[model samples]
Target: MKIFIAGAGAMGSRFGFMLHQAGNEVSLIDGWQDHINAIIENGLEVNYNGQEFNIQIPIYNQKDLDINSKAELIIVFTKAMQLDEMMKDLQPIISKETKILCLLNGLGHEDVIDKYLPAENIYLGNTVWTAGMTGPGKVKLFGTGALELQNIVPGFEKEANEIAEALSSAGLNAKYSDDIKFSVYQKACVNGTMNGLCTLLDGNMNEVGATSTSKTMIWKIMEEFRAVADFENINLDLDYIYDKILEFNDINKLGNHYPSMYQDLIINHRKTEIDYINGAISRKGTKYGIPTPYCDFLTDLIHAKEDLLDAK
Candidate 1:
C-alpha cells in the first residue's frame, strides 16, 4: 500500500517506520521544517522496545508535497486545530478511492473531514499507543498498544477492514469496531483524566499516578466524564475504566511518560487537544443541562494557561 502520514510527529513517525519496515511504501507529510529536513537527511530514528533504529522513508513538508503522488491511504495525525489547513493542503493527493483515517485524539473531527473530502472516504478511529518525539526525526515508542477503527460512512467497511488488516500486519495491533464512538469516548476519558493533571503538575505518568492528590483528581475527572457520558448515552462504566487505569499504572505502561499536552505546552505550540477531551465533556454538559463542574473548571484553567502562553 502507498501510505501518506499527515503529521509525522511521534505517532506518525512511529507508524511510518513500522509500515516501511513491513515492506510497504510510506511517505510522511508534515509542517515541521526541522523534523522533515532531518528525516530527509538522516532517516527517521525510532526507539522501540528498548532498541533504537533508523528507517529511510520519503518525507515532505507541506510546501514540497508532490501533487501527482497517489496515496492509497492517508492517515491524519495532525493536531485537531490543524485539520482544516491540512485538508486544504492535501487536496491534491486525495483521490476518490483513497481512504483517510483519522487516528487523532478528539471528537467532532469527522465533521471537519467530511467538509473537505467525501464522507465515503473517511474513517474514524482511536489508538492507545504511547509515543513521544524527542527531537528532529526522532520518536520514542514507550509502549506497544492497540488501535480501534470503524467506517464513518456507509458502505466503507470493506475498505476500512483492508486498511486495518494492513496496519495489523505491520504489527500495529489494529482492530475494527462497529462502535467507533465508544472507543473514542474511552480514549477521551483516559486523556481527560491523565493529560491535564500531568501537564499542570509537570510530572510523568507514573509520578502522577503514584500520588494521592493526582489519584483523587483523576477520579474526580473521571466522575465528571461519566456523568457527561451518561447524559450523551455513551456506554462507559466509570468503575471499569478506573480499574483499567489502575492496572496500566501498576504495570508502568506509562512509566516516565509525559503527556503529549505537556510537551505541546512546554514547546509553546499553538494548540492542545484538551478542548476535544475535557472541553467536549463540558460542552455536552451544557447541552444536556448536566453539571460537569470539575471538567468545566479544569478546562477553563487550561485555556487560561494557554492564553497566557499565547501572550508571551
Candidate 2:
C-alpha cells in the first residue's frame, strides 16, 4: 500500500516505521519543521520495545509535499483540534480511491471528516498503542497494542478487512470491527480518565492509580462519559471498562508512561486535546440534558492548567 501518514508526531512516526519495515511504501506529512528536517537530514530515531534503531523514511512538511503524489491509504494521527486543517492540507493527495483511516483519540471526529470525504471512504477506529517523543524526529514506542476500525458505511466489509490485513501485515494488530463506535467510546474512557487527570495531577498512570481515591475519582468521571454515551445509544460496560482503566496502574503495563496530554501541556507547554476528550463529553451532556459534573470539572481544570502554563 502506498501510504501517507498525516501528522507525523509520536504515534504517526511509529506507524510509519512499522509500515515501512514491512516493505510498504510509506511517507510522512507533519507540520513540525524540526521533525521534518531531522528525518530528511538524518532519519527517524526510534526506540521500539527498548530496541534502538534508525530508519530513513521519506517525510515532509504538509506545505512542501508534492500535490500530485496521490495516496492509496492515508492514516490520520493529527490532534483532535487540528483534524480539519489536516484534511484540508491533504486534500490534493486524497483521490476517490483513497481510504482515510482516522485513529485519533476522542469523539465527534467523523463529523469533521465527513465534510471532506464520502462516508464510505472514512474509517473510524481506536488503539491502545502508546508512544512518546523525546525530541524532533525521535520517538519511543513501548508495550503492545491492537487496532479496531470499521468503515462508517456498511457493505464495505471486504475493503475494510483488506485494510486491516495490510495493517496486521505491518504488525499493527489490526481488526475490522463491526462496532467500532463502541470501541471508540471505550478508548475515549481511557483518554478521558488518564489524560486530563494525569495532566492536572502532574503524574503518570501509576501515580494516579496510587492515589487513595483513584478508582472512585476515575469512576465518577467515567460515569459521566457513560451517560453521554448512553444518550448516543452506545452501550458501555462500566465494570469492564473500569477494570481496564485500573490495569493502567500496574507498573508492568502503561503505568509509568505520561499520556499525550501531559506531554503537550507540561512537557511541551502546548495545548491539549481536553476539548475533545472530557470536554466533548461535557458538551454532549449539555446537548442531551445530562449532568456531567465530573467531566465538566475536569475539562475546566485542564483548561486552567493550560492557561497557567501559557500553553499555546
Candidate 3:
C-alpha cells in the first residue's frame, strides 16, 4: 500500500517506520520544521523493541508536499485541535479512492473529518501502542499494542477488513471492530482520566497513581464519563475501565511515562486536546441534561493551565 502519515509525531513516526519496514511505500507529512529537517538530514532515528535502526523514509513539511502526490491510505495522527487544518492542507492528495484512518485520542473527530471526506472514506480506531520522542526526528517505541477500527459507512466491511489486513501485515495487530464508537469511548475514558490528571498534577503515571487520593479522584472522573456515555446509549463498564486505569499505577508497565498530553502541555508548551477529551464530555453532558462536574472542572483547570503557561 502506498501510505501517507499526517502529523508524524511520536505515534505517527512509529507507524510510518513500521509500515515502511514492511515494504510499503510510506511518506510522512508534519508541520514541525525541526522534525522535518532532522529526518531529511539523517533519516528517522527509531528505537523499536530494544533494537535501533535508521531507516530513510521520504518526508515532507505539510506545505512542501507536492500537491500532485497521492496515497492509498492516509493515517491521521494529528492532534484533535489541528485536524481541520491538516485536512485542509492535505486536500490535494485526498481522492474518492483514498481511505483515511484516524487514530487520534478523543471524541467527535469523525465530525471534523466528515467535512472533507465522505463517510465511506473515513475509518475510526484506537491503539494501545505507545511511542515517544527523545528529540526531533528521534522516537522511542516500546511494547506491543493492538488496533481496532471500523469504517463509518455500512456495507464497507470488505474494504475495512482489507485495510486491517494491510496494517496487520506491518505487525500492527489490527482488528476489524463491530462497534468502533464503543471502543472510541472506552479509549477516551482512559485518556480523560490519566491525561487530564497527570497534566494538571505535573507527574508521570507512577507519581500520579501513588497519591493517596488517586483512585477515588480517578473514579469520580470516570463516573462522569460513564454517565455521559450511558446517556448516549454507550454503556461503559466502569469496573473494566477502572481496572485499566489502575494498570498504569504499576511502575513496571506504563507508570514511568508521561502521556502525550503531559508532553504537549508541560514539556512542549503546546496547547492540549482537552476540548476533545474531558471538555467534550462536559459539552455532551450539558446537551444530554447530565451533570459532569468532574469533567467540567478538569476541563476548566486544563484550560487555565494552558493560559497561565501561554501555551500555543
Q: Could you estimate the TM-score for every candidate?
A: 0.94, 0.98, 0.98
Over all chains combined, what TM-score does candidate 2 have?
A: 0.98
Instruction: For candidate 3, write residues 1-312 as lDDT tens digits.
Output: 999999999999999999999999999999999999999999999998789999998888888667566789999999999999999988889888999999999999999999998999999988988888889999999877899999999999999999999999999999999999999999999999999999999999899989999888889989999999998899999999988878866788888879999988898888999999999999999999999999999999999999999999
lDDT of 2 by residue, 1-312 (tens): 999999899999989999999999999999989889998888999999889989999887887667667999999998999899889889889889999999999998999998998989999988888899999989999989999899999899898999999999999999989899999998898788888888988899999889998888889988988888988999999899888987877888989999999998899998999899899998998999999998999989988888898998
Residue range with the least summed lDDT across 10 consecutive positions in model 1: 246-255
lDDT of 3: 0.92
Q: Name the regions of candidate 2 deviating beyond 4 angstroms.
A: none
Q: Please name the candidate that would achieve the greatest lDDT relative to the true structure.
A: 3
Q: Which lDDT value does model 1 have at 2?
A: 93
